[model samples]
Target: MSRSFVKMNGLGNDFVVVEARGAPFRPTPEEVRAIADRESGIGCDQLIAIEPTANADAFMRIWNADGSEVSACGNATRCVGWLLMQAKGDGRATIETLAGLLTTWAAGPRAVTVDMGAPGLGWRDIPMAEDMDTRGVELQVGPIDAPHLHTPGCVSMGNPHVVFFVANAELAPVREVGPMIEHHLLFPEGVNVGFCEVREPDRIRLRVWERGAGETKACGTGACAAVVAASRRGLAKRRATVTLDGGDLKIDWREDDGHVLMSGPVAVEFTGVLP
Candidate 1:
């Protein structure tokens, strides 16, 4: 038996999207790991399984390269939106995930705009282990060059995130503190850590170390979370261009809708059969 798959990327955050609606078999953790293995398999930052849903849009599942089932993935959502648009000839769309129904729209050339719902900013909502005032978030990481790194703004973009404001994101010890903060006692569920530097009122530079998945070219939710965090900090405005390693994402936190709209490019890399 074989399954068809599409390899796509949103700002180089690659994904292998498998449409398993009519398929009889689901991918195992090991199999998902293999598919995301660049050396041995299809190669991707993550693997997305698209299954049928009842009350909502298509069911979307995320798997990390290590084969762990994750809660949410934003770039993959855009990639899947592109894949579905090509397959179903779409103008607008929605997807069901463990989080909730995610809405997407056809926008810009090679770009899909996703309404990533609202940012979840609560002590228990972000699902942090202990009780802390989310209105003014706090954390305890080892040594940071700056003291403020410990008290980053926290939010959940379907997945957990901790956005730290720095003078220069590149200078921050992403590889060092990222792992430490990701596995910190506060976030029992783990989290994607982002270092953000405000370039302007409408621009920010971010470098992310994703949870489950390590450093990648870009992270859509991370970008959104960063913008929201910056907005809360009075650094960046409601709309900001988040510059990631791969490219820029236009994030607009609509004043009326209250949805974080992520706009970015999606590119088809290749397609193959799953053996």
Candidate 2:
């Protein structure tokens, strides 16, 4: 049977949103890959399935373009929250995922804010192969005498992330080093790689290599994790604007609540029925 889907994006990180609230819509791994194929199918960075939930408005299932099922995706959450809020004619919505429950609200016109919960800083939380200092994990790239990126901060905003403080985000070798660190033996479960350049205490430039999706135009959780990593390393403030390749995102690591709030605009690219 054919199913209707909405193509949405936060910044330029796109998704194929399938609402499976009324019926089951479980696609095989190959189907997911096909749906995410840019050349032949309805391409998207991730395929999101919105299913009925008892605790929250919906349960979001995330599948990467490579067909790997992941626990969390912040950009997809904002897009889903916007859709739910539009349907309910309200500004607030709750979404549940393997990461946990996320509360979101309409920040402004076509913009949404999501409380991404507290960041996990423990070595066990990042779940490295063995215990290590998460603030600046022992990892390096390039030659030992002149390393390109080293001593990255490790944190988990629902998923594992390793952020390198670079001098220029544009110069960072995302394609070459990203995959090398993503499949690094230390991460074990694989990890998202972020190259962050702190422009000021309040602004940051970032680029991300997502675990299964390669380098997307933007990554919401990656933005949040970048800010958190910067703050932890004392390079930036608790709250800052993360400038991604596609656009900017306002990220606030709230001091009182210990929750990370991410605000950004969402867009509906198009809608169609899956063939």
Candidate 3:
């Protein structure tokens, strides 16, 4: 059977979204990889399935380009949220994922704000291999005395992430160091790596190497995690603008509620049928 799909993107982090609310659509890891292949398939950073749910507007299942199913994806959430809201002619939508339930609302034309929930800061929360201060874990790359990168702040925004504060985000060896730290022993389930350069108290630049998916134009969850990690290290404020390769995102770590809010734009690239 053939399935209809939509191509969507949030800050260039693209997705091929399939709606299976009325029917069951289950694809194996290899199938997911084939569909996400740039040259042979539809091509996307992740594949999203909008499934039926009892408690929320929809259930979003995410798979990386490598075909690994993941618990959360911030960009995909915004894209799905926009689709739901547009269909219902409503301003808000709730989505369920393996990570948890998330609420999204229209911020503007094609823009959305998502309640990403509170970040996990404890050692066990990040699920590191050993106990240590999450603010600045004792990990280093390169030389022992003066490593190229050291002491990254770890946080889990539904998924594990480690942010390395750098003097210059553009100069960081993201491709070289990212893969090394992603599979490091400290992160038992692997981790998304972020290179962040604080430009100001309320603004910064970031780049992420997502686990199972290489570097992309943007990563919504990574942006939220970067702000949270920066705040923890006194590098940036609770609320800030994160500039990624694709575009910008406004992240607010509410002091009162402690929930991180991510605001960005979503776009529909096109639609197609899957054979």
**What TM-score against the true fold does each predicted structure earn?**
0.94, 0.99, 0.99
In TM-score terms, candidate 2 sits at 0.99
- TM accuracy, model 1: 0.94
| Per-residue lDDT value at 55 in model 3 | 91
- Tens-digit lDDT track of model 1 for 1-275: 77888889999999988888896446788888888888888888898889988855588888988788888889999987777776677777788888889888889768899889988988777779888765456665555565647678888999999888889888988888888888888888888999999999999999999887788899999999998888987888999999999999999988896789999999999889886
Residues 21-86 of candidate 2: C-alpha lDDT, one tens digit per residue: 989999999999999999999999999999999999999999999999999899999999999999
Question: Which pairs in model 3 have colliding backbones?
Answer: none
lDDT of 3 by residue, 147-255 (tens): 9999999999999999999999999999999999989999999999999999999999999999999999999999999999999989899999999999999999999
The C-alpha lDDT values of all candidates are 0.86, 0.96, 0.95
Q: What TM-score does candidate 3 get on C-alpha atoms?
A: 0.99
The 10 consecutive residues of candidate 2 with the worst lDDT sum are 126-135
Q: Which 10-residue span in candidate 3 carries the lowest summed lDDT?
A: 140-149
Candidate 2 clashes between residue pairs 3 or more apart in a chain or in different chains: none
